[model samples]
Structures are given as structure tokens and as C-alpha cells.
Target: MSVYDDYEMTIGIECHVQLATKTKLFSPADNDARDAEPNTKTHQIDFGLPGMLPVLNKHAVELAVRAGKALNSPIAHVSRFDRKHYFYPDLPKGYQTSQMYNPIILAGYVDAPLEDGSLKRVRIDHAHMEEDAGKLTHHDGYSLVDLNRAGTPLIEIVSEPDMHSAEEAKAYVSELHKLMVYAGVTYGNLYHGNMRFDVNISVAKKGATELGKRAEIKNLNSFRSVERAAEYEFKRQVDILERGEEVVQETRGWNDDKQITISQRSKEDAQDYRYMPDPDIPPVVLTDEVIAGIQSKVPMLPGEYREKWSALNLDKSVINSLLSNQDYAQITLEVQEKSGEASAKRVAHWFASALTASDNDTNDDSTQTMLYAARGS
Candidate 1:
């Protein structure tokens, strides 16, 4: 047996999901900056101008409540924000407003379904509200900072180190993304930075009591990248240990072209951030009525739809294709309710065939045609 066979890997993930709010987290700036000029979407609060104070956005809180219901977690009636001090060119405020001691969403768990029809339960430690930093672009000799993305509302979902393999990590992220999207919490556009993942990976000897030092791969935008990075990092750590060296605890970056992890900087502890309660913003206090009102807006989740469609006995691939788009899943369910099981099965097969013919293309035109066809029949 290979030396690598005697080792085990552990992984945890932190995801930053941008809330689909109309404005920035604490300012009246335009939230959608896809095609705007570099700094046009920023406001005084985002720029951290003097004498500027942040006003809490109620819509963001409403969405967070919906998110809590989707995650099968409880919403904290009282949660406060703190200041995480760090220096970076993109952070105009020099400190990020986040939840450190108390977060909005409490402990939760996600039953991620594996390919073999087994479920891996991943525990969520917590999810906190925060604002995003700006984008930095490096040129030949200088770097440009764009504040367009600064101060955008985000909920960072942090999971426990419960995942044991790369496949589990991928499955967990995919389920999390679906939950967020189906709940109408965020746009769930991975390419547009609506959701970004930071994967923390560690390796240890089989049956060892303690886990090895971990290296975090930051800002991964795709699910495949998460799985590939974990696989590479585990091997890298195992090789280091076999050579009588130790794995360094640091932040790393994924080279998608090379399929390798590169060290970026040493990881810092919480004390390094100098966390302090924010003096400007007050604590978020929600009543039972408010939470119930917001949570009522949450739509059917992927798991619920899967359970509803399980009676059809369709292939797993077909079910996954239907669940790819919210409309498709909803239509399939509606057909089952209106017509009968046989009709719904036919509709499901039609959607699966269309998706396969289009190479799983989810473009608006194709989606519209499918919706029309499903409605007509």
C-alpha cells in the first residue's frame, strides 16, 4: 500500500454570499456594479469618509431570516456587529464591520447527498453578516483599487471541519449554493462573485487523535475548483509529512491553469484582527413576529423538491437537471399536482431531454421555450 493510503484529510468551508439587496450594506450606493464605472457605485459611507455613519439596511436582515430557514438554522433575535481591523488597499475603512462574538444565524446542519445515495451531514458552526471589500487589479507597475464592490452586504456561512473527503466538500458547497438560490436570498451567480468559497484543508495520519495544520485556499469561485484544490492540497501535505517536513499553516491561492496550490501569507488568529464592537451601529434586534413574517417568504428548497419528485422513480441525473433551474423544478411539481404521476414523469423526461440536447445550457431563450412547452402541455 502507498504511504498516502495511511493518511486522512479534513475540510471545512466558509462561503461569502452577496445578498440581493437594492443598495450597499450601509449606504445608498447602487448595489449592482456589473457594468458601471470603476468608482461610480460607491458612496460616502463606502469610502469611509469622516463624519459618515452607517445606517442599517432592513431588507438585508429580512433576507437573512429567509436564509436561516433555508439552512434549517435558528435566527438570533439579538445580534451585534464588530469591527475587524486589518490593513489592505481595497479596504477604505481600514476595518471591516462583521459579527465576531454574536452572529445572526446560529448552529445548523446540511445533509449533503452523495453520489452513492448516502448523506454526509455537515455541521454549520455559524453564519455572520459582513460587508465586502473592493476589487484590486494589478497592472504592469501599479495596482488599481475599485470601490464598486465595497460595502456590499454579505453573509459568511462557516461550516465545521466535518467533511472528510474532497467529494464531500464539493457536495456540501453545491447543496449550500442551491439552498441560498432557491430561498431567494442571493442571485447565486458564482461567476459574478455572488458566492465565493474559502476551503480549509488539513491532513493527518489514520487513527491519529489530532488534525494537522491546515492551509486555506481563498476565493474559489467554482465547485470543481473546490474539489480539485482539496485533492491537490491533501497530496501536497502528505508529501511534505513524508519528507520529514511539516505543513505550514497559511493562506494559499489556487492556480487553475497549473492545478496546484501556492502559498500566499501566513494565517492570522482572531486576536490579530483586533476585533472590537462597532460604536457607530446598534445591535440588530428582531421580534418573533418579524422573523416569521420574513421567513414566510422562503420558497420550496431543493431537498423538498427532491422528496416530492422521488415518487417518479426517475434517474438521478434527470432529477439533478430539473433542479438546475428553479422554474423547471417548480413546473415539474405543478404538473404533478395538476395532472398525474404519468404526465409529470413525461414532463420531467422532456426537460431532461431538452437539457441534454442543449448540453445543459440554461440560457434565457432555451429556458423560456421549455417553460412555454411545459405550460402548453
Candidate 2:
């Protein structure tokens, strides 16, 4: 065994992004699930009422299509929905409506630069649409189900195993969360249950040909806890291997208070989901015109926006800070539009420290929606 066994770690993260739609993806009912009249936001579709037809929210579709374009993925002209057979107290329907065999976005990449001055292009296997499960609220050691979020729109982003450390894994998740926030596709609030990550970790020898078995860290609620969970898992695996034990592929949970990952269950196989086309809904046929319309709505994406200001004469720290929070990019653009290129440079300088202190994406999706709609989307 080489020392690299302790140092070399491979990681891949799957992020669950909850889209910011005013209403449920397939129902016209308002989507204020967290704070609304109890069950008032829901409709027949969410309740799985018999013969209830699912009407695809065109806005949600447009947002999903826009996201696919931003990720530079090949859009599935005609996407299909499947039913993931599962039984949970939180799920009213026997199955979840999700995109599986035919996801709208396929094989994308997110550019995550490494510490070695080399850019790591994170391979995105797919970004698929799915309805969120209802929130489970536990009271007095018993759980109560809330269906408000049952039918909320969500997209799951699966990334390739391109990371080597827990920190890198955390960075990748942060980058994606920020991208979604900046794009106005998601709120990016991990605590609000708006974003979640299921992380995979494995170990390898210095010169081994085959990789070690993998363990998944499920439901890492916040970004801060992700690295700790991965570290504990890595140590657990290393100790098990040192004792001549095999690493079983299983799912674990991060105990943030205790700073460890406890085994939850053996990782389930794909067949467990029993994925099949949803018999109730037809295919989500995406027209070229609709695709083009959504594509046109994609403004200077995060990368493009950052590059546009990278060369500007500004403080390095300021540049880094602005790049971190995308509001800085929009603020710069606003400064430029209202004034000139020189003024835009000034805007970056002015917003650097102030924006860094706030520690949130100040910009919201409504600003873009109004701006884009005004441009005739």
C-alpha cells in the first residue's frame, strides 16, 4: 500500500436543485409551500386525485430549457417523464414523476479550476426534472407530513467523479449552488431545504489500476458539513482497509453536531426504483421555437459575465469577491449601462467589500424575469 492511498480521494456529487417557480410544475396552484395556507397551494394533481390531468407549467419548462442551454447540454427535443415507484409517508402518489431515460439535458460540464492552475471540467451526466417530495415535520418524536412541497419543481444535477478531495467536492457543490442562484433558477439556500447534496467518496492506491468501493453521503443539508462528512468517511474507509476489511457500498448520513457520517443503509440498486414511463402524462414535446425562445433568454451566463470583467483594471481581491457573488457582475453591468465602461470598473470596486460582507446572492429571479419578458420572451 502506498502513502497515496491516504491522500488520493475521488469524489462525485449529486445536487438537488429546487426551481423557483411561483406555482407547482404541473399545476397552476401557487408554490409557496413553506409558508402558505396548509395544503391550499396543492391541487388534485399533487394529491394524486383520480383522473387528475397534469398540465406542464410552460414557465417551468422554459426555465428548465434555459438551464440546459446554460450548461451547454444537448437538449432532448422531446423529453419524457417516468414514474419512480417508491412508497414513503411523504409521498401521496405511489410513484414520483421524474425524467429518467430521456432527461432534458444530457452530458454537460461545469468548469471548476483546480489549485494547480489547471481547470477541471466537471462532467455533468444529466440534469433531469422531478417533483419534490413533501416535507416531513417531526414533532414529539413522531413525524407529521406536510404536502405543501410535495409537488414543487426540482432538478437533479449529477456530476462526474472529477474531484480528488472533500474540499474539492465542497467547492464543486458551492459553484453549482451559486450558478443556480445567479441564474435565478434556484434560491440556493441549503438550510431552507432548497438545495441538497448526496456525495460519493472512494480511495485509491498510488499506482493501483482499479478503484476502491464507493460510499454515498446522503442529505448533506449544508455546504459547511459536506467536507467533514467526506473526511470521516475517508478515514473510516482507510481504517477498514488497513484492518484487511472490504468496503461495502452503502449510504451514510452526516451528523453535523457530532462531525461524522453514520451508515444509513446499503446503497440501493437502480432496479429498486422500478422506473417506468408515467402512464398518466404524455411526453413533454419541446418545439424548436420554444427551445430557441428559452435560449434567447439566457443572458451573459456566469462564466461569460465573469470573463467580461476579468480583464478590467480592478483589485484582485475585489475581482475574486465579485466572481464569488454574481450580483457583483450584474451591478457592474448596471453601472456600465447607466454610465460607461469606466463607471462599470468603479462599480466593481464599490461593490467588492460591501457585497462580500452581505454573504448572499442579493439579486433575485424576478429582476431577470421582468427584464427578459420586457425583451419579448
Candidate 3:
């Protein structure tokens, strides 16, 4: 047996999902900064100017409610925001406004399906609402800060350390992404930083009762990166333990080009941030009726669609392809409802064929319209 077989790795993930709202979390600035000029989409609140106060976005809260249902988690009847104090070049206020003590999403679990048809259940600790900081662009000798992304709404989903393997980590993140997208909480665009993941991983002896010190890999945008980073970190930790050395608890950055993780800085604890309740914003209080109204708007999720399509006995690959796009899944279900199982099965195969032919470009508007036309016929 390999030396690596003697150790086990534990992984937990924290995802920052940008809310698909028209305006920033606290400001009236445009939230869609893609291809926009720097600083043009920012507002005074984003810049932290004097006399500026943050106003909570109601739509963001509604989206969070929908996200709660998607995760099988309960929403807090009353949630408050706290200021996480930190210093960074991109932070204009020198602190980030976030939900610390009372997060909006409570305990929940996700049953991620592995490739071998087995399920790995991962627990979610909580998810909190926060505002994103500005972007920093570095040059040879200087750095520029663009506040366009500052004050953008975000819900940070924190998962428990339940995942053991890198593949399990990848599956969990993939399932989480689908949940958010199908719930209409975020746009789920990885390229544009709509959903970013921070993986906290540690390794220990197989029979050890306690988990070893963990190093966090931050701001990974792709599911593959999460798996690769976890695998690399696990081996690195094992090597350290094998050499009679201690692994340092620090924050690391993934070098996608080099395919390695680089140490950024020592990870800070909660006391370091000196969390305090924000006076500018009031606590978010929701009634049962409000939550029911918001969550009722969440349409069918991926699992529901899978259960509905199981009766057709289509190939697993075809079902997976249909689930990749929300519109495709909705169209297939509509066809099933309108015509019959046979029609729905044929439409699903056609969509699968079309997706393969186009190389998985499901964003073609004209082509999507034609596919929707198939539902009617």
C-alpha cells in the first residue's frame, strides 16, 4: 500500500454567490459590471464616502429566502449584519459588512450524487449575506482598485467538514451550484465571478480522532480547481507530517497556470476581525407569510426533474445533459405535461443531441427559442 493510503483528508467549502439583483447590496450602483468601465458602476456608498449609509436590498433578502429552500435549510426569522474589520487595498471602508453571529441560512444537508451512483451527504453550517469588495488590478510596480464590484450583494454558503475525498468535494460544489441556479438566487456564472469557492482542507492519520490544521485555498472559480487544489493540499500535508514537520495554518492561493498553491498570509480568527453589529443597517425580520411567499416562487429543482424523468427510462447521459440547462429541463417537463411520456422522451433526446452538436453552448438565444418551439409541436 502507498504511504498516502495511511492518511485521510477532510474538506469544507465556503461559496460566495453573487445575488442576481439589479443594484448593489447597499448602494444604487449597477450590479452588472461585466465589460463596463472601471468606477463607472460605483456609487458613493461603494466608495465609503463620509455621511454614506448602507441600505439593505430587499430583493437580496428575497433571493436568500429562495436559496434557503434550495439547500433544504431554514431561514432565520430575524437576522442581523456585522462589520468584519480588515485592511485590504480593495476595501474602501477598511471593513466588510457581513452576517456574522446570526446567519440567514440554518443547518441543512446536500446529498451529492457521485459518479458511481452513490450519494455523499454534506452538511451546511450556515450561509450569511455580505457585500463584495472592490477588485484590485496589479501592475509591475503599482496596483489599481476598481470599485465597480464593491457593495455587490453576496450570500456566503458555509459547508461543514464532511467531505473526505477530492471527488466528493467536486461533486458537492457542482450540486451546490445547480441548487443556486435553479433557485434563481444567482446567475451561476463562474467566469464572471458570480460563484466563487474557498476550500478549507486538512489531513490526518486514518485513525486520528482530531482533524489537523487546515489551509484554506481561496477564490477558486472552477469545480476542477477545487478538486485539484484539495488533492495537492492533501499530499502536501501528508508529506509534511511524514517529514516530522507541522503544517502551518494559513490562507493559500491557487496558481492555475502553475497548478500549485502558494501561501498568501496567515489565516485570521474571528477575534482578529473584531466583529461588531452594524448600526447603519437594521436587522432583517421576516414573517412566515413573507418567507412562504418568497420560497413559493422557487421553481422545480434538478432532483425533482430527475425524479419526473425517471419514468421515461432515458439514458443517464441524456438526463444529465437536460439538467445542465434550466430551460432544457423546463421544456422537457412541459412537453411531458402537455403531450405524454413518449413525446417528452423524444424531446429530451433531441435536446441532448443538439447540446452535443453545439459543444454544450446552451446560451444561444435563437437556438434555444427553436428548441422551446419543439415543446409546442
Per-residue alpha-carbon lDDT of model 1 for 1-377, expressed as tens digits? 88889999999999999999999899999999887889999999999999999998889988888889988899999999999999998988899999999999999999998999888999999999999999999999999999999999999999999999999999999999999999999998887999999999999999999999999999999999999999999999999999999899999999999999999999999999999999999999999999998998789999999899989998988888888788888999999998888989999999888776344445678678878888767
lDDT of 3 by residue, 1-377 (tens): 99999999999999999999999999999999999999999998999899999889999999999999999999999999999998886878889999999999898988887888778999999999999999999999999999999999999999999999999999999989999999999999899999999999999999999999999999999999999999999999999999999999999999999889999999989899999999999999999999999999999998899889889998878987888888888989999998999999989988888677244545668676767577786
Q: Between candidates 1 and 3, which one is better according to TM-score?
A: 1
**Model 2 over residues 1-377: C-alpha lDDT tens digits?**
65435546788888888888899878877776666656677788888888888887777777777778766787788889998988887777788889989988888988754445356678899999998888777789798877888878888888888887877777677667767776677766676778899999988765667778999998887767887888788888888888889999999888887888888889988899999998777888877887887788676666676567665766656756766655556667666666666767766665564444445444557545533432231
Q: Where does candidate 1 stray beyond 4 Å?
A: 356-366
TM-score of 3: 0.97
C-alpha RMSD (angstroms) for model 1: 1.3
lDDT of 3 at 89: 69
Residue pairs clashing, model 1: none
Q: What TM-score, over all chains together, does every model reach? A: 0.98, 0.87, 0.97
What are the Cα lDDT values of the candidates? 0.93, 0.76, 0.92
Count of backbone clashes for each model? 0, 0, 0
